[model samples]
Target: MQWKQNLNHWLHHLPENDPLKIELENYQSDDKLMEDCFYKELEFGTGGMRGIMGPGTNRINLYTVRKAAYGLSQYIKDQGQEAMARGVAISYDTRHLSKEFALEVAKTVGAEGIQVYVFDKYRPTPLLSFAVRHLNTYAGVMITASHNPPEYNGLKMYGEDGAQLPPDAADVIIDYMNEVKTELLIEVAEVKQLEKDRLLTYIGKNEDIAYIHSLDSIKLNDSANNKDLSIVFTALHGTATETVQEAFLAFGFTKVKYVYEQCGPDPNFTTVKSPNPEEADAFTLAIQYGKGNNADIILATDPDADRLGVAVKDEKGEYVLLTGNQIGSIIIHYLLEQKLEAGTLPKNGVVMKTIVTTELARAITGTYGLETMDTLTGFKFIAEKIQEFEQTQDHTFLFGFEESYGFLIDGFVRDKDAVQAAVFIAEAAAYYKAQGKSLFDVLNDLFEEFGYYIEETHSITLEGKDGAEQIERIMESFWSNPPLHIGGIQVVEIEDYMTSIATELPSGMKSPIDLPKANVLKYKLEDDSWICIRPSGTEPKIKFYFGVKGKTAEIARNKLRKLKKLLLQGVHV
Candidate 1:
């Protein structure tokens, strides 16, 4: 009955000729659909909000976009006149309605007399983050759903540091968002007025040049023989093709080829089932191109160009997609070895990875006498560390990555940058090729030196209101009664990030966790295997991440499979 009343409110306020109005009218008779759409307002979390695009309050649309922008605008205004003068930088990806949503954000923020910089056209998420600091803006907004399906679009907010808003800043915006009575009543500035008052400006090539120019410092080797490395790249119909090509050219990588079919932006993602580079199917076209071109490496970036997927030829001459952890291991080893050779390796060097990331990073950094720190599961936490290191001058951030294909090479861009990763991958490939090896070979070498490290992530998708309740039940069940042994391996310690405590088995001794509070749990096994469980902050799913190390690849894989099965048996999907 409440949802019906909410539906009626929308029908009463929306214009008769509006597209959303027509959609609402057609779906009015569908009770289940109506409830799903009007059950509650779309959630704006620490990373901002994402959901299906439609007319209802629960869906992401023009009104919800405006409401989010209004909250951000109010938050900026609270920071005083200088914050208003510094303004916000906005960009979008290749998703449907991305450009429209971005323009709406600019209009809404500008209406509050805050200056705005809008990209002339679509750009990657990292570019948006870079534009925030590059232009000295107070905040930033990216209109994108990253690698979500075509029907989904959302917004992500950033701070002055060019990273996703931390929990404190995001909390203030949520408070402001809840004070708004209705999304339908939000107002925005007209385009003509925004331009006339100089409250809005469009940025393009010049900013891009500066971003690319910054890459020069990330290079560790001269890499004059760039022609030795052949690379095949696909943007997955997203936003990184031109920028990646430009960076490659600037870095002297001329043997790069693009997957023509999936080169440009396509909201429908016509060539792939999903635009997510993490999935193997997303690289189907890229793999074909790589094999045909006899390329040494294949690269793919998601719709936002913030995450990268890599494939390399093995000994059999068949291309196999490398896991995020594997790619990261290769990059770290290359950087550290090259740095050591050049005598530029800092004694205080540091590497950062998420808790769920492979421990191979730690082992690699340890060899060079560098420290490795683990953050919670988001890039924002890693960014937080980078910021801290800057003020304290404690350690130099060499690299940071998550297991889900997101990586950041330098602090110039405070988020995962696929353009930077692509160039580095190319450079790394060339450096190895001159040494009579490939990336795959380098990965195998790392595993041989260190033990074989394998990692996998499994997710259970549960949608709708009932699904939310089920996720809650699952977390409670695990927290109240954790297993003493998983896959027959003894549980040495259990960490509950929600309570910020780690409990050692048997003794029940507890220690404080220094990281920020989050809803997550990690079970450290007697062996070098661990499992992490957490509800996805951006999607309706609970994810399980498993990692294991053994003497060989098969041993590691078997251990991973057993651990995953043991825990999955207890969780009801």
Candidate 2:
């Protein structure tokens, strides 16, 4: 078989004493395991490439790390002397091989005569983004899988604007990656020696200070910064403690408590099933501490600290987890209200959200006279919008968020920032406290003002090569033939992002979709409900996103249940 031939090729090239060779020898007797590892190389997906740690082309080991760095090195070289001199900034999280992979990239990039700046230890993803712009580097690398399971790790690449590479630039990097014949044979420069030559610099405290200073500008309610609220924070066994804690202290919230078990750099993420803030089970420890301390709000950040999960007290004094949509809308309401009162709200302001995000954002922004913009499903597209607004100065970029618990408040950092988000949540909680209400009350009032909007995402996991093909087949089926009705609701319109067209169903009136083409299908129901089906760009699964707006919360919940059930049944994977 071709996979066996590739396996033998890798084994032949690896040295006997190498750690990867030793690992391959142990799995030699198992054909399935070896085939899984050797069948294909890990490709850069939505954010970047990610895989389990092991010894093959499909795995995320040192050699694959070197391969990515090699590709990036060549790309920088092609950009000419200025890019080489400006160099790359690299950082890692608490995951296994994170630091090792980061160092490997530095060495590989330096070996190709490009200067490299690397963190001495683990840092959050946003800091890496901030560092890219702060250091005036041409590119940046963050070694993290960002909320994936413990066994998974990956690298995310950032362009000079500090956003993930858009499709055009990613194509160039992939071309360079494909040209690397033998990854294990790539050479690396020595870090210690490179330091002496001033080609390698370790970044930490200074960058942290500068990043913290930038985060401070996200605050809108100076009067609401009183220490009137009790808060509980958890890093979920990752790298958010120091920065998050410092930011809360800066906001004068003296009653903040930390979930000790989940604090600070634990690659295993021992406390939770998954260190994802989007999941309810991931907040067990934080909620427990919150209940014990009678905290007003509970905040949890994922491993790499880019996404934040929140729990707020309801009128009954029970802790309720806030969906990403709920949290984002709360912040938008608070910021918009404050700015409007202060008369600082920009007349031509814009709020950005992913196509699948809650329509509540549009409702809230519209009431305040701010326009809303929708981007394709990724933070990179949102970042690109911010870059455009900054260059054109046509509109003020107020805030951008995704349904997956990622948010960006300030354009200073061209990515989602839990540090900035944590601060805002704290202030928002306090603002409500001053008004003798809770965060839940604020959301309830919003629902009463606007229509009740509910959104949920569900996915089915499939693995290996066959699973990938299955996902594609499922998407293709939806693209070629879409159902006229789902759960007794007639389909009114269909948006085919992959074809960059929107067709009004039954009538068949077509309009061009200005966004980039992507393999995603969205169905707008006759009742104004919607369902979106798209393959998970960063996972071996297919995701189904459901959205429903009703006159009341109970009505919205029931509609969401029916639509979700119907859509999940149709999704084969």
User: Local distance difference test, per candidate?
Assistant: 0.93, 0.90
Among the numbered candidates, top TM-score falls to 1
- Per-residue alpha-carbon lDDT of model 2 for 1-573, expressed as tens digits? 888887888899988898989988988999888888988988876457988888889999999989988988998999999999999999999999899999999999999889999987799999999999999999999999999998899999999999987888788778888998878789999988889888899989999889888877887878344587999999999989998877887788888899888897888888899999998899898888998999999999998889999999888898899999999999999989989998989998999999999999999999987899999998999999999998999999999999999998998888888888988878988988988989999999999999899999988788888888898898888877798898777899999998899999799999999999998999999887888888888888888899999999899999999888777776665
Give the C-alpha lDDT of model 1: 0.93
What's every prediction's RMSD, in angstroms? 0.8, 1.1
> lDDT (0-100) at residue 438 of candidate 1?
89
Show the colliding residue pairs in model 2. Answer: none
TM-score of each: 0.99, 0.98
Candidate 1: regions farther than 4 A off:
none
Clash counts for the predictions, in order: 0, 0
User: lDDT winner among the candidates?
Assistant: 1
